[model samples]
Target: MTDDAGLLEETAEDLFEDAPCGYLTTRLDGTIVRVNRTFETWTGLRRVELLGRRRFQDLLAPGGRIYHETHYAPLLRMQGSVREIALELVRADGSRLAALVNSTLVTDASGRPRVIKTTVFDATDRRGYEQELLRARRREQEIAQHLQRSLLSGDLPATDGLEVAVAYRPAVAGIEVGGDWYDAFWLDDGESVGFVVGDVVGRGLEAAATMGQLRSALRALASTGLQPGPLLDALDGYARRHGVGQMTTLAYAELRLRTRRLRLACAGHPPPVLVAPGARPELLGEGRSLPLDAHAVRSARAEATLTLPAGAGVLLYTDGLIERRGRSLSDGLDRLLAEVASQDDQAPAALAPAVVHALHDPGHADDVCLLAVRIR
Candidate 1:
């Protein structure tokens, strides 16, 4: 060979031995024919121990060996090449290392496969980063769950002449905790019951914090015996003062058991549904009012009064209950009414679960909060 050709071959040999990735050449039957210095160092095996004596498959961990025999080798043989794939390699001392491997068939001048050329890249750092990302996601979910529990009122308050039950179901499992909340507490007189159901516009910790603030402020105001309309007005004022953006929907109601009367007010929220004894369930119609943060914009006030006869129940719910994607609001309302009408005679507690199940379906796409009050 000419001197220049010899120099070129020497340079190529040096580059292959010091390449960043591990390289190996194996006979078609799997005997290792040649290996780069990087491969020998990475496996803690000297060239003498690896060359001609061991096969490429011998370096793989047990599971990787099985996968190679069952899938990788067959696919490579059919396709003539295999791209980057994750696999575990067993080192000389029996330790395992994660790696990405790429392999291709080497053919002779006769167009027949003679050997397999494989490149291995360490993936331990990439795997560590992936594990870190999963841990961060899990931590975020844990914090969200804690915030959701804190946003909830510990227990349903006992009220005179009323049976109240509340249920909250998140849209997704694990990460399902969200900003929907319900509260039932007695006014100062201790004879009147005031309740509110509301939803924050978003999810996660920020929404949960806003929910907590709104629920606390509303409860504090309701304790002073404000009627439904005035109570919501107070809430709107508080929301504006706090600079809470246009991101809230709420329905507030007060039940006067002495007179079997209910006064309700809504702020850009779905109207409450009332089920009377031996009567169909119907939504209480009230005027439309803007949600809390829309205070700057002139909006109409909403109020309605209904007489709750003995054995009737009033339901306050978040939009998640009757709302479904690709369905009109009217259609959702109709479905809710049908479901309520089909229920058997049951108390508010039992009826609450039935209503939730009725709203339950693969089509439901949001979190739900349901609060029911029955006049005994």
Candidate 2:
């Protein structure tokens, strides 16, 4: 052979044998026929012991072996190639090494399958780092869930002739808490009850913290016997001065048991629904203004009042319930009123969940809260 030809052949062989990644050729059934030097080095096994003796899958862990049989082999045969398969390989010392593998099926002259060529990349460091990230993410979600529960934990006010119930659901996206909150508590007079449904502007841990602060603020303000309009005024002032729930939308209502009277105010919030005895259910959209802290100089928020005659109920919910994508607000509102009218005879506790569940869209990623109050 010419000296230049010998040099070129030697260089080609050296490159194949010493490549950083492992390379191997196996029979159609995965029996190893040719393996590069890098493969032997990574497995810590001698070529004499592997050639004609072991199959490629023999070095895989049990789960990876199953994957090879069920997925890898079939995919390669069908697609003629498969890429980036995650698997674990058992080395000579029985320790498992994380690997990413790719394979191509070589065909014979008549296009029949002949052999398989595979390349393996070590992924120990990458797999470990990915696992660590997942663990940290899971830990964060757990902490947020705990915090969300603690902030929302409380019982609704109970009294004679007056019933209140709430249905609170986080966004459908799993493993995370959202900013939607509902609260029902008694004012200082103990004869009047407060109903609130608020949606903060953001989500996650910070949103939970903000929701807690706003909830506490509402409870404290309700203790002072402020009317719904003035109460929202106070809350807007709080949001502006404290910078906590800026642009937060909420509905506030005070229901007096003796008079069966309800006064409600809305700030950039959906109007509350009123279901009257022998009358149709409809939304009270008159009291709404812009959400809190929406302008540099906020204007006075309006409030509406109505006597809750016997068998009348009020329903308040966040926009997540009736503000679906591609659907008009009027349409959603009509749907809500129709559902409530159909089921108005049900008790408040049962009615609240049933109405919200009927309108819930699993594909929507927002919190849903429903507060229903009935005066007997």
Candidate 3:
């Protein structure tokens, strides 16, 4: 042969033997007929052991063998080819290799199946990366859940002539913990109690962290003896200055037990529902304004106040309680009035959960927070 022709033939043989991927051929019944150098090198098995003594399925893990017969074999027979099927193979030393496999069925001149040709590519690194990503997502969810539980854990104010209760449900999507939260705590020793239900603007751990900060700030601002309207104004300032919880929505209320005076304010949030003695439920909408940090500055927040006749009830909640897709806000408010009207006579301790169970839309794509208080 000429030198150039000899060199070209030698390079072709070398490429077939030392290609990056494993290559092999098996008989129609899957008996090993031929294998390249790369296949023997990959599985740590020699040509002598594989030829006529073993089949391709013998190199698969036990579970992979079943998958090969049930899914892979039939698919190749019917379609003449299969691509990117993932499977595990057992090496000669009992270790395993994660691989992506592709195959084609070869036919002879008689138009009958002659052999199956397959290419195998290693996939261990890719599989490891996917597992690590899933683990990271799980860890973030756990941390958010733990932080939320700790922030919400506490006792409600209980005293003579007053009853207080709160109900909360996380978002239905487990993608992340939500930003909704509720608090009912004492402003003074026993005379007044403060109620708060707030929602941060986003989801996941960042939203939970921002919520913790806002909850703490609101509680601190309320302790300064400010009424609901002024307290909300101060909270708006706090949020703007800290550059945290921008556009957060919330409702704040202070109830005086002895006098039955209820003061409430809102920031782009759902209005509080009031059920007076012998009257239909109504929403206190006079005190609402845009959410925190909506603009640089604006008119001071206005608060709504009314005398809560003895045995009257007030229900405060976040948007998830009444809102639904393709429904008007007024419709949600009207529906909420009906739900509260039904439970006007129930004890405060039972009112929150009952209204939540009745009016809360499980289909809403956000968290739910409700606080119910009754004057005794």
Model 2: how far is 350 from its true place, Å?
1.5
lDDT of 1: 0.83
Clashing pairs in 1: none
Q: Mind sharing the TM-score for model 3?
A: 0.82
lDDT of 3 by residue, 235-275 (tens): 88888888999999998989988888888888999888887
Ranking by TM-score: 2, 3, 1
**Each candidate's TM vs. the true structure?**
0.80, 0.86, 0.82
lDDT of 2 by residue, 1-376 (tens): 6998977766767888888899989998888888889988888977888888899999999988999999999999899999999999999999888999999999989999999999999999999998999999888888878888987778888877888888887887756788888888878887888889999988777888899999999989888878888888898899898998888999999888889888889988888998888888888887787888898876788988888878688999998899788999999899988999888456788999998899999988888999999888
Off by over 4 Å in 3: 1-16, 24-36, 45-87, 100-118, 343-345, 360-362
Model 2, stretches more than 4 Å misplaced?
A: 1-10, 45-49, 52-55, 65-83, 104-114
Q: Which parts of model 1 have CA positions greater than 4 angstroms off?
A: 1-10, 24-35, 45-90, 94-119, 123-126, 173-176, 298-300
In the order shown, the candidates' Cα RMSDs to the true structure are 4.7, 3.7, 4.2
lDDT score, candidate 2, position 355: 89
